[model samples]
Target: MAFAGMLNDEDVRAAVKACQVPGSFDYKLFFTRVGLSARADVQGQRVFNILDRDQSGFIEEEELKLFLQNFSLGA
Candidate 1:
């Protein structure tokens, strides 16, 4: 079986491709900022606005990159 994280990665990738989400933040980057391990869809959205920072729902690509660099997620 694939690791749970891997599944989350796939899901996030799919979501990214579908343009269901805005920005290039991707799944792994998002999981880290909100301190989550899974892509719990609706459950994860609550914190998304916080990361958005500008209340734009769509995070700026540059901002996402910086956010990822600052956070240290578990392996």
Candidate 2:
């Protein structure tokens, strides 16, 4: 897919395999590692505010890019 440039076949396969395994993913730890508090809701405003790098109360293109980069998703 489009992420071929950022991820190899093995990397993609590993992710897919990981998801296929039952209870293998710890979503709370994942979110916490990404600067989010798992104690609150996943789609909470706190998550939005953390992603708003400029604190402009609105997420812009650049801010979104940085946020995606944090997850190694290739801005």
Candidate 3:
């Protein structure tokens, strides 16, 4: 898989418990529960990177998934 699913639902529950009972969020895991990386987080980063096109570090709404239809590796 292209995503690093290191944090699971159990981890989220544990995190919530730790947040309320222990009063601290696992800072290293704040982004995992929300699905936001490619290799270390979720698929969002890879998707965004593909859509970024110009390497501007930002994605515009226009460059959607049109490219995925003809997707191929090593292009």
Candidate 4:
């Protein structure tokens, strides 16, 4: 993954742990934690698509919750 170098495992861990709902994060928090907040809309959509899992056109709560596990099981 080209963006792998931009991710800090520790930061990802922290963000995952910070989810108040125990297993999910809203788009705002997810994007911010993953460093997508400043990207262009097109870039953000690409990231969202990667994480959306079900191809339902949105990152449902459960999908959002499993964001880390989906991409990096160890995270």
TM-scores, each model vs. reference: 0.38, 0.41, 0.29, 0.60
Please, what is the whole-model Cα lDDT of each candidate in the order they appear? 0.48, 0.51, 0.43, 0.66
Number of colliding residue pairs in each model: 0, 0, 2, 0
Off by over 4 Å in 4: 1-7, 20-26, 70-75
Model 4 Cα lDDT, one tens digit per residue, 1-75: 434655566666667666646445565785588677877888767777777779999877677557677455643
lDDT of 3 by residue, 1-75 (tens): 222353344544444444453335444464454333323434556645765777788654344224321232211
Q: Is candidate 2 or candidate 4 better by lDDT?
A: 4
Between candidates 3 and 4, the lDDT winner:
4
- 1-75 per-residue lDDT for model 1 (tens digits): 212333344443443444434454456654553346554665456445545767787877655554443432211
- What is the overall TM-score of model 3 with all chains considered together? 0.29
Worst 10 residues of 4 by lDDT: 1-10
Off by over 4 Å in 1: 1-37, 72-75
**Stretches of candidate 3 exceeding 4 Å from the true structure:** 1-40, 65-75
Model 4: how far residue 26 lies from native, Å: 5.0
Q: Model 1, 9: alpha-carbon shift in Å?
A: 16
Model 2 / residue 37 / CA error / Å: 15
Give the C-alpha lDDT of model 3.
0.43
